[model samples]
Target: MKAFQLVSPGKTELRDVDVPEPGPGQVLLKVTGSGVCHSDLHLLHAQQLPFPMTLGHEPAGQIVALGPQVNGWATGQHAICYIVWGCGVCRRCATGAENACERFPRGLVPGPGLGYPGAMAEYMLAPARSLVPLGDLDPVDSAPLADAGLTPYHAIDRSRELLTPTSTAVVIGVGGLGHLAVQILRAITESTVIAVDLDQEKLTAARGHGADHAVLSGPEAVPEILELTHGRGADVVLDFVGVTPTLSVGAGVVSSYGHLTVLGLGGGSVDFSASGPPQGLPWGATVSRPYGGTRRDLHEVLSLAQRGLIKVQVERHPLAAADDVLARLERGEVRGRAVLVP
Candidate 1:
């Protein structure tokens, strides 16, 4: 099998490697497509992890082999690979919150892409529990639904109640996740959708996707949101880019009783002090950080994709072009999710 391996600082080289066999309780998938996520940029650029790291998690493929003790699934069955492989007996895993599994707190096992080999190669070894049946959807197109779509789905699912018809929902950062967030909000709720972004192209993409209003994210953004909401501010804010500026804008434009969900791993923080966005953290307004969607959330997202209620914009590249794709993503040149095909 061939894979793009991260060998040194901020570099990746395509090389041939031994195809991994499915161990007991595991399944081997012949990789069809894998999404190159923005989050992968941070890790691949740092190169702080061990050498020869395989760096893709969002994958959809067909099952080719199953190990001992694996049943109920057959070869040639298509499935979406669930990224967070959790310990089944843990409380979080029992409830489908694999991202919050207790094993991570105990240093028991790392996630598939973090420590184990990822899905960028021609073959992927996944736990039996990590495979979700990808019914009629194309594996190449459905790849982004695992992370780019699932992340926003989890955030919106957490803040669904606040997104009523009378409410104004603002999505900051109209990139991969932001684009999907716009579609999800449009399909599920009647809230007025406002998208904010630095790039005019992305903002235009947002409007075409479903945003009622697309505004440049800057000093003019909060005022426009306030005007759109008639000075009440937005009732729901999904900030996919969690930088200090975006967080300030997100917190500043949130209504007193609204919910602000920050899903980006930009390492930005919010202070509940006098100098923060709002004068005082008054009323029931809250800032919440969710890691990713639960297993059930991904299932629901995939179902939405299957029914064609939502569509993701992706640029497909050959698996050998992983390095070029990474550079494009790092330079912020890719418009939407980039899928790598084997």
Candidate 2:
């Protein structure tokens, strides 16, 4: 079998490895599609990593074999992999919020492509509990729902109370997650969806995904969002790019008492102050940094996709092109999500 492995810090290679068999409670999948995520690029250049780890987390495939003790899942069924492997005993997991499992390290996220062997290969091994049926959706295109779609769904679900018809929502960064965020908002909420992005192409894509307004992100973005909201600012701001500029715009345009969810790994921060508005977030505003979605979230995301309310705009590539695809993603040239077909 061929696998794309991170050999050392800031490097990756396509290497030959033996096919892994499913262990107890696990199922082996014949890889059909694996979505390439920005997180993979982050892991490539990470300061530290578990070398020789396979490098893909979002995978969709058909079940080929099930290990002992695994039941209810059958061979040849198409499924999407839920990447968050949480300790099921934790309080968070018990409540279906396993993305924030109590036993997970404070700063480190351990999952497929992070600490465990991933799906950027001919086959993948996943716990039966982590498998979500893909139904009739194309496995190659539906892979990104594992993360790009599910993450924003979780963030929006948490802030659903703020997205009433009279309210407004802003999405910053019209990349993979942001594009899906727009569609999710449109499908699930009546709040006016405003999208912001530096690239005109992405902004156009956002509008196509049902964003009511698209604003080119810059010094003018805050005012444009404010204008769109009639000077009240957005009731919810979802920042998919966590860089200083986008963070600044989100802080500038979120209404007082609104919710601001930052899902990007851009390594940026904002200052907090008692005197709000210009110096900090508005009074009563709340900010959250959410992780991946729980099992239920993944199921809901797939339901949306199955209903044709949302779809991932995917660009498929061969498994051997993993390096090139990561390069393109790093340079911000890949639109929508890139999937590796094995």
Instruction: Please tell me which predicted candidate would have the highest TM-score against the true structure.
Output: 2
Model 2, range 1-342, lDDT digits (tens) per residue? 999999989878899999899999999999999999988878888777779899889989999999999999999999999888888778887876678888975955577787888889988899898899988999899999989999999999999998899999999998989999999999999989999999999988898899999999998998888888899999999999898888989889889999989998899887788884567888899999989988899999999999999999999999999889998999999999999999
For candidate 1, lDDT tens digit of each residue in 163-259? 8899999999989899999999998899999999999999999999989999899898888888988999998899998898899888878898898
Counted clashes in each candidate structure: 0, 0
lDDT of each: 0.86, 0.90
- Candidate 2 stretches with Cα past 4 Å from truth are 276-278
Query: Which pairs of residues collide in candidate 1?
Result: none
Instruction: State model 2's lDDT.
Output: 0.90
